[model samples]
Target chain A: MDNIAGHKSGLSWVTNISVVVLVVLWLIPTVGLFVSSFRERDQISVSGWWQAPFSVELTYRTRGDGEVRPVDGGYVMEGNIFDTGEVRSSFEGGASTVSAFGDRGVAPAEYPAGTVAEIGDGETLQVNADGTYIYTSVEEPGNRGPRVYFEAETPPQFTLDNYRNVLTADGMDRAFINTLTVTIPATVIPILIAAFAAYALAWMDFPGRGLLIALVVGLLVVPLQLALVPMLNLHQRLGIGQSFLGIWLAHTGFGLPLAVYLLRNYMVGLPRDIIESAKVDGATDFQLFVKIILPLSFPALAAFAIFQFLWTWNDLLVAKVFLPSDDASKVMTVKIADDLLGSRGGDWGILATAAFVSIAVPLVVFFTMQRFLVRGLLAGSVK
Target chain B: MAPRAGFVSLKGFYMPVIVQGLLTIVIGVGGCIGYFYLSNLLLDKVIFPAKGENAGRNINRANQIRPWLFLFPAIFALGLYLVYPVVGSFWRSLYGRSPSDWVGFDNYVQLAASNEFQQAFFNNLLWVIVVPAMATFLGLLVAQLTDKLSWGNIAKSLIFMPMAISFVGASLIWKFVYANDADIGLINAIRASLGFGNPIDVMQIPFWNNFFLMVILIWIQTGFAMVILSAALRGIPEETIEAAILDGANPWQLFFRIKVPQIMGTIVVVWTTITILVLKVFDIVYTMTGGNFGTEILPSYMMDFMFRDDGRATAVAFIIMIVVLPVMIWNIVQARKEMR
Candidate 1:
């Protein structure tokens, strides 16, 4: 009985352990992104993402110049770098001061000018001989701001600053709009063309119908890179090259083969009886397609739409190929990637935020457009 | 009402029949063929062109034209956008130029000899082999497993959620997973916490990084496979499973002998579908690593050439096209076989 009970407990424990393990494994990076996205740069450097959101053990030293003006009667000196408002609010009222203005965090016993600072207030603080001070003020108000005394536990406060810098300060705002301009038309144009082609391919019987489709399928294997020069040439001939229209056309051209293939597969699954009956009723293919087939193929259309939208949105290569290399026409993916890798690759904060921002639109798109993708249009077709 | 009317009015019937049904069918079929062969420009001209079929049925083929008239704008657009570029890509592949400084076979030879081209080709080969196989395998596995259960819909939905994530989003998500720093990426953090060495650069791991990139494609595509395969699996009649069971066929035998054979067509379709996807596998690699660190595939390499402002990009593009063409033919043939 003891052996059996132990085995059973172990089995359950193993299952529970796996579940916990999987959940943690999944959450580790997610939790990191959430934490790193919030923490300041210096904090991020000191602790791993997991150790973040916890009170970090940090030591700070405060200093005052007190060097230039050696008013012998009083202890006043002109500081080198710090003017008024040099100390943050954390230092505004806390009992902190520069202890021996040396370079290192673990400073030597003496500064260049042999100066020291101690706790004081706005009025009646007296500096004594030998770098010491007496803060004795009658009118000192109660310390109101964050206390700056050494070793104060500053609980992690997440801020909107990262998001702000990413959205506004990073020039992502223009890139965001530019990306949408490129992606929306790029996505929409292909779906529109592909839907019609899909319908025609699935329903309409024409000569080389097999061949036309084979051609599209053939085009699929022909990597977009293969077409870059030719398309650029055509774009030049058409004079739409390096324009938004050119990029959109490039995306649409590249995107359509898959779109047509998918939508055609989906359309062929619609009830042929409905289509035949509509044709029997003197409805033209267009009328039949517009009224019946398209409505029926919505699930597939939406799925393809979402797919195209995302592909185009995230595309940098084609945008670079067809669109002008000018800043105004550059899409978000290109802008974020090029900018970061060029000037600020090491700025992980800016990079992370920009990366997230670039993908934010597509993320929203997927969540909403996903449901239509769930329904299998062909479920009842073969039966 | 028309059932009785069909036999009568022979003179009225033959003329109306010849004019309306026969002519329209002929023109529709004719136009379809015309568009198919004559490249894009001619196809567009035939469909929409400057001339409208304004004449009455007696004067012109306007009656036949009326049925396919709605196809004009779309056909024109398709011709201009998709069809034109295909021809353009092929035509442009013939010449190497910064702008019409034509070097004929030079481009092809350059492409054939290029180290970058070879790398991209091999990488593409890897993508074509690995991505489709893994996607099909996982999708089939998920579909089969989920199809057996009662609360399968929820399980399937949970699995399918990744499909809803775009390639870029998915890459971002996994970037966090593979981040070199523990705080930034999950896998590294776990490794560090488990007392492993310092964090590993998963993306920078060459050769394997291709597979690492392929994993993202697999993740996104698995949901696609599961959805399609599950639908196919569901279509298998329950009686068949019951009959196999009654015949004393074990689970494996029943699955292989009965269920598997029935859905082999769907499986082929799924495989070929994914195979086509493998040929065009660009975004995940491009987005994740910029095709650097030994990850350059055909499309990414082509993009590199274009960005370098070199004519060689076109030649590379042509080689990629040649590589993909045979597979394209195979896919079409498979699809046709399925149709038959």
Candidate 2:
């Protein structure tokens, strides 16, 4: 044991290291997206969120104003402090300092009070700490604005407003509802149809049953992309193009092969005796299915449901083709893909949050139903 | 217990079954007649734009025939929505656009002759060959390595988490790692740091781009392979392994002789399963590079055809079917064999 431990621990180190490396490889980009999603766009441009925890420096211009005070030291101060909202998004908080503050647009170490520096604009500006500041109109000015700079403390942090923006985008909410509308029914219908087909194939005595089962399995290998254009053309000819029914049928057709494959395999493994005993008790096929087989096949049904649901929910192409993208039927997958895939699809935060949001349902589906995948419900039933 | 009274089945469940069949037939015939009458009314009404003597009864009284009138609409919708599309696609595959001009065998001929089509065909062939084999092999290796170990379940769970991620999500995730900027795309940053000149566009290279695209599918599929193969691996008898070890067999020998042959059927299932996936790959390619710079595969090509409103789209779709049909048959054969 000692020799084995001594010899193996060193070798085990490599395995551990590699595992860690692989884990990090998978996690880094996902983490990067998460961090980038919360940060301001300019902040994202300037530095990575990983370095955000350390000291951050921000330089800006501020003016002596907004005081309106006759203090013991100053005797006179007046102005309103104003912040253009653009500055707030970039400011880093914590261990932050103003490199310069001035009425003039210059990074200077110091500026004296009552120094009315001329900014390019006709307006003159003044500022004070209590955030009261004002700008005076210059003589003979036409369409010019005030200039003020104050390097305020910026902390390394961000908010979830990007996620809010993405979720609240006009198309996204509709698409989300649209995805649910398509996916939920699509997932349900196939499972219902396939369960009956599977039960018959598994338990019923009918001619050509094996061949039909074989054909369905064969259909499994046929890619849906092969079916797509023809199907669309079919929909067009049939005069059902770009409708809810079109997408539902598309999802059902695409989901069927796997659904039948999985369900039949599971049903065939069911205890034949229970089905036969039901027959002896005069339980009709429907009764047998509803009372006994359905409950037993729950695990398999659940697994397939999760599979179908996730796939349908996450589907973009079928939704794009069959469902009209014109407001009513644009699903989440199509909408999010549009948001992220073109133009500034490079925005890490919006993509991550949206990406995370899209998978949130799938994750729930998986967690809730994963037990069915491995649980040996039919284990003792047959043997 | 309720006994069947002569010809009547107990509780008459069979009555509904018979009624359903009869109703289907009635709806089928009634639907054609209804369509004809409706068109006649349409022709008379639209060209004439005049009120008929029975128009009031025709409109309101038609609604009063039966509450089951909704049932007819359901039937009509099914015919229009489902059966009509399949028949149309099949018919369209025969003729050119507009359903009138006969272009039998020409679309197929054009596809067969073109090098682009051949390249796509061969690329799909490569994907079918390579992805399943590599993913299944890697998965089997990982599954076996992780099996019987204390932490194997955790390893499997961690590896499988990517499968939970949507393909688009995954593509976006990888995008940053492969991003073009220094702060962006991790690979290039590391490459530059390591003194490599020029960042490579992994998704854009011809011939080699398929492999880069395949990597994501492999990454997602390997976890599936592991879980399934892990189950099949566990079904292997411990005595067989132990007996092999007792002899002059080593780890590699045990793996090849004992562990592998036992799980060969399952290996085929997983391989063929992923091969099916390779045939339908669209989102990854669509997201990563939009099937450009010589990265076009069959699915993406079909999408292009679809968007362009090309006759070639249906042709490509049909071609994809031809490629996939044999593999499907093989999966069924393997499945039957596995059942036995």
| Per-model TM-score of chain B | 0.78, 0.72
Candidate 1 chain A TM is 0.74
Docking level for model 2: incorrect
- DockQ for each numbered candidate: 0.15, 0.14
Q: lDDT for each of the candidates?
A: 0.61, 0.63
What residue runs in model 2 are displaced by over 4 Å at the alpha carbon? A1-14, A49-95, A98-154, A237-239, A374-383, B1-91, B112-119, B195-201, B205-207, B338-340
* Highest TM-score scorer: 2
Please give the fraction of native interface contacts (Cα pairs under 8 Å between A and B) kept by each candidate.
0.26, 0.24
TM agreement with the true structure for every prediction:
0.73, 0.76
- Model 1, position A287, has a per-residue lDDT of 61
Cα TM-score of candidate 1 = 0.73
> What is the lDDT for B286 in model 2?
84
| Best candidate according to lDDT | 2
